[model samples]
Target: MSFLLRLTSRLTGRQVGTDRFGNVYFESRRLQPIYNRPRRWAIYARGGREPTVVPPEWHAWLHHTVAEPLPEQKRYPWQQEHRPNLTGTPESYRPAGHDYVGGTRRVTGGDYEAWTPGA
Candidate 1:
């Protein structure tokens, strides 16, 4: 966080709520002149700067999609739990033929022949 944000948040921000990840959400005390709506923002949790760390309800509130944060509901058994993005991390998924797993890809028999120029 920068000094300007800290100062602005202190002066103009109101505590809205914190997400399960510990990210703090705030809304401006006064509505912004241009949008005519209070500005909303979030202070990410430590090591939780990745945007995907935010749950769907919190994300909606931050974007002003809803007047208030949605209440939590019981998840269905078939529903998958939320997870942060892991594209560049070791925990990310790798296909069977990927270089990191193994360079060789298994060959399957095929009837198609390679094309040649005019032959």
Candidate 2:
């Protein structure tokens, strides 16, 4: 976070809510002429500011897709916990046969064989 952003957020932002991960959500105190509506933002709790860290409910709220924030009582038994995207990280998933996994895909014998032209 830069000094200017911190100052702007402190002066114009109002704390709206905090997520389970401790990330703080905020909205502009008043509508801005540039946006014509109160802008929303979130400060990441973790060292890296990964957008995926924001849960689906908060994400929807931040993008104005929902009028109200997620309610605690609305959660269901099947709702899965949020997990940060690990696409390019060391902890990312690699299925079997992946070089990183040190596994080779098994080649099963089949009836079909490659045919060369004029062979």
Candidate 3:
């Protein structure tokens, strides 16, 4: 976050909550004249500037979909914990045939023939 933003937030923002990722949520103490509602925003945790790091519950709150963040609800046993996007990182997923994996795809028996334009 920039120093100007930090200063603005501190001056006009009222902290609403903090998420598990350490992100802090806030709302403008004074309502916006155009919208007649307090503006909402977040201070992303270190290394979490990617918007996807904001969990679903917090996302809804940030967008004004709800008056307040929904209470934490139980997750299904099959549900997995949230993780930040890992694209471009070493931990990102790579298919078996990707160059980083082995650049060569295993060939299976022919399943069909290529189609001709008019045949």
Residues 44-88 of candidate 1 have per-residue lDDT tens digits of 775535788889988888898899999877999998877888899
List, residue by residue over 1-119, the lDDT tens digit for candidate 2: 56676678788898889888888888988887976888899888874568999988799999988877876546678987779998999999999888999879867789878999999
Candidate 2: residue pairs that collide: none
Stretches off by above 4 angstroms in model 1 are 2-4
If candidate 3 were superposed on the true structure by all CA atoms, what would the RMSD be? 2.5
* Best-to-worst ranking by TM-score: 1, 3, 2
What's model 3's TM-score? 0.81
Name model 3 segments beyond 4 Å from true.
108-119
Best-fitting candidate, scored by lDDT: 3
Please provide, for model 3 over 1-119, each residue's C-alpha lDDT reduced to its tens digit, 9 standing for 90 to 100: 88888898989998999888898889999999998999999999875368888888899999999999877678899988888888999999999889999899888678879889988
Which residue runs does candidate 2 get wrong by more than 4 Å?
74-77
lDDT of each: 0.84, 0.84, 0.88
Q: Judging by TM-score against the true structure, name the best candidate.
A: 1
How would you order the candidates by lDDT, starting with the best? 3, 1, 2
Clashes of 3: 0
Clashes of each: 0, 0, 0
Q: lDDT, candidate 3, residue 95?
A: 90
